[model samples]
Target: MQYSISQDQNGTHLDWQHKNVSPEMIDWFWSNMEKGFLLWHPEEHEPLQWVIPPKHGNLIGAVHIAPQTWSDGKRQNLYIRFEDFNSVPDAIKQYIEYDHCIIVAGLGFGEGSLHVKEPLGYRIHQWQSDVQNSNSVGVIGKSNAFGWKKSENHEQGMIWAKHAGTEISNWGLFLPQLFDLYKVVKNTKYNPFMDLSVKRIDGVLQYKTAN
Candidate 1:
């Protein structure tokens, strides 16, 4: 696992790699959550439920609610709404090529996303507070503060950073096994293990078979 902290802001960047874990596997985990989340972090994460299930397996506009326990020992319900890389602001987009990134919001703290890049790793970016002077980025409550304010709740941000690392790191332990099983499953209605390409049309993320 690899991670970095933003010295000037309240954000965390994490990356983890697991053998044979493809982007499709990541999609499958989100498309059929609950079980995977529980497996990843049984102690801090509870079963996740869809507030609004995806349409035809597309994750954009899909909403999921997960009960999570923070490092502060506070339990909070996160309502995450999935979006596409297009939703990422230009300020951040200019830094990286996010063609296959899965963006999300409604964390009540900030915004975040999952990006799978070359050399094969899962990149996680959690912006726990406002960015580019725009409140539109995060569309949730601020009760937790998400450690955005450097002076006030920076410690809370640190806790979140460490917590996120632990969760993603745990994924490396089991995802490879799950992927192996997925490869052998036959007679399935859909192949969730196949690599899919992401395209943004008119501001919405659309998935299609990769060439």
Candidate 2:
């Protein structure tokens, strides 16, 4: 599969040609693209601050997201933000924002489809353990994040996950692993997230999602 990225006044756009790309994948890509656009212009929303605990003398950086308030009064937002931990000269003292970050997780495309990972659900399970050990905030709420696996071959794609509040401790520890996973999966020739365990499949290009 071949893909290209371009930017215009409208925002960044992705164009690709692939044989096995599925309808579900196209929908996933477009939805994520819209979310990306919103992040750049999140002036109207409230920024939620995330704080992770210190580990081995190194403190993970904080994360912020502008959550959209629903008509029913639910505040929710789904997006991706990546920060480089190694670049921080002093992780113990810095609180970095999303302004300098990139979408390193939560979005992927290959094998003729798009993939979104729901590590937050897995995070919730970890949080449960933390709560058992008295290391968490102990507040349980509906995960602002919810989705299903896109491909049949992989047990993991995007799944459902519960979201704890912004002040959850030790949550930042998951960043490095998640980022590494993103780097590996996105660059692989075959989409491991897809069924058939193949990256490029023989099929037809019915149409293009974006020109």
Ten residues in sequence with the least summed lDDT for candidate 1: 139-148
Task: Predict model 1's lDDT versus the native.
Answer: 0.49
The per-model lDDT (C-alpha) reads 0.49, 0.25
TM-scores for the candidates? 0.62, 0.20
Task: After superposing candidate 1 on the true structure, give the runs of residues whose Cα lies further than 4 Å from its correct spot.
Answer: 2-6, 92-99, 107-153, 182-211
Model 1, 1-211: lDDT tens digits are: 3434443352444433333344445555555565477877777988887776765445666677778897789886756666555554443333333334455554443133222211111123321212322433221101111221123245655676666667766655676567566566553333333223455577555556632
Find the 10 residues in a row with the least total lDDT in model 2: 121-130
- Candidate 2 lDDT over 19-138, as tens digits, reads 332223322222222223233224334544322211221112212233555333455454333223332123111222111111222222231212233322111111011123243222
Whose TM-score is greatest here?
A: 1
